[model samples]
Target: MNTSLPPVEAAPTGPDAPPPGAAPTAPAKVPMAELFITFLIIGATSFGGGVVAYLRNALVLQKGWLDEERFLSALEISQALPGLNATNMAIIVGDRLRGVVGSVVAFLGITLPGATLVMVLGVLYASNAKNPYVNAALIGVGAAAVGMLTAVTFQIGRKQFGKWIDVAIILVTVTLINYLHVSLIWVLLTVGPVAVFIYRPSQLEPPSVPPKQETVP
Candidate 1:
């Protein structure tokens, strides 16, 4: 009878290790000018309910300024803050990247352009209450905003599904939030403990001590 060789175990890899001279990965650094420009553009384009969705796209998907987890955390924090969600998010994200100066720059980037645009629109609406062009433009922009929001949703869903448990949580949270209109606190209260119970990683035990040498030794 012939004996087959046992399967070999793979070697552990170090962070600096790469396969066959592959290109090295670079560390991420914040680009302040780009950050300001991005938020400014998002502010100008984001109308009505499009702020959150556009911010997600501009910051995470398009610019890669923040990863998914960081983006989600910023969103949560912004929501808890007083003021508009987009503006609050700008401050948080800016501060995260460039400290206080970054926060101020980000705020001005989002607010100044938006303020000017809104004021102009307000004047126009007041002067020309029944203008067809205004109505048409608003309707078209609103539809585009919906498309952007949908894109943001899809992006977030993709990130969440990177983990199987995340997918389950997402599905459940979406169901509760959409159908039941429950607050996030309630959702967290229901799912947080259960998730902890189910997915908690096992703590490693200390190596066992051998029995004390016998007195006969």
Candidate 2:
């Protein structure tokens, strides 16, 4: 007689889990008008490059349109590609929610508010270009923007900072950019690949759903 270990069933995966060959499930269909309104709010309110913060709060916290993991995944994809992060995010999120039309609505909704405001502000600034008060106001706005950016960065990267590797990467990137005056191109080319390789699919473990508790016999 031979003894063998019992066959082990794999743990259930979350939304991304479908069988290896099966297509991943589609995103829930959202009403076009509602989607447009959501992004419009983000576009109008988010200022001084604080769009990402507004986006996180709107998409994840307020709307529940995307969970934390999915939002971060989308953010990662957006940042990796070209163009502005704000617009890139709009395209990805919109496409995920409603395909091509969703993408268009999101892009327009997020951009239109800022574009219109910029047109008006540009005209105003052109007239008041040398006004001392205007310059002071602009300086204040810049400082606020910096604070917002820093806050959002901490919020998003808080968990990742638990990893020493992540902390090291961040410090290195900052030192290179802020202290060494290395170009962004050099930083991305060098740090980007290392980060990717470290977090590559082969090395990382998938999130596992807890097994159901069994009842007493």
Candidate 3:
């Protein structure tokens, strides 16, 4: 008399099982065309040199393409290297999303609009160099550019402004460049090393003191 029920199978474990309480990661593959279009929009619309802010807003906040930490990490790499921040960011983010094709498309998208606009402006400027109206417009544009630059500088440096060391470095650098008329090369060679040393890991360590000796009876 076989009365025993069939044994129930346990759920599969190991590689087949998703880890308990772990979140699913976002997809890695973004479309190349999407990358190009995103940068194209940024290039055409971003003005006043606030492209970094625009980038953060679009990629991190609007699109969810990158988290804040990841965006900042990429920005740091871009800033450390020699190139326009916008293009550098385009290449890094594009490569991260889709590889070589992504990089090429992003670079073209970010640059093409600006390049075309610049060429048109150059032609117009050359033709109307002595026109009073054009001269007035250029002056107005320059003033606006200065204001934008100052605003962007302070916005980017807000965190650093709270720190004394950063403020000191900034002041010294400004004095050297503006007041002393130091050559850019010499300033970089000297101030760069000093600033690096000031913030080095070794300088962050707390000094070790010998333990107090026991008193004799």
Please report the candidate that would top lDDT against the real structure: 2
TM-score of 2: 0.65
Per-residue lDDT tens digits for candidate 2, residues 1-217, read: 4444222222233444443324224434456777888999888888766678899999888766787888999999988788888999999999988789889999999999989988999999999999999999999999988888898788879987898989999999999999999999999999999999999999888768686688897
The RMSD (Cα, Å) of candidate 2 is: 15.1
Decide which is better by TM-score, 2 or 3: 3
Runs in model 3 lying further than 4 Å from the true structure:
1-28, 205-217
Question: Which pairs in model 3 have colliding backbones?
Answer: none
Q: Give the root-mean-square deviation of each candidate in angstroms.
A: 17.7, 15.1, 12.4
Ten residues in sequence with the least summed lDDT for candidate 2 = 5-14
Candidate lDDT scores, in order, read 0.77, 0.84, 0.83
* 123: Cα error in model 2, Å: 2.4
Model 2 lDDT, residue 17, Cα: 47
Q: Ranking by lDDT, best first? A: 2, 3, 1
Clashing pairs in 2: none
TM-scores, one per candidate: 0.47, 0.65, 0.75
Residues 1-217, model 1: lDDT tens digits: 4444222212234334444324323324355676678888887888765688898888877766677788999999877555788889999999988789889878988998879978998998889878899889888989998888888777756876687877888889889999989998888889778776775566334558896777974
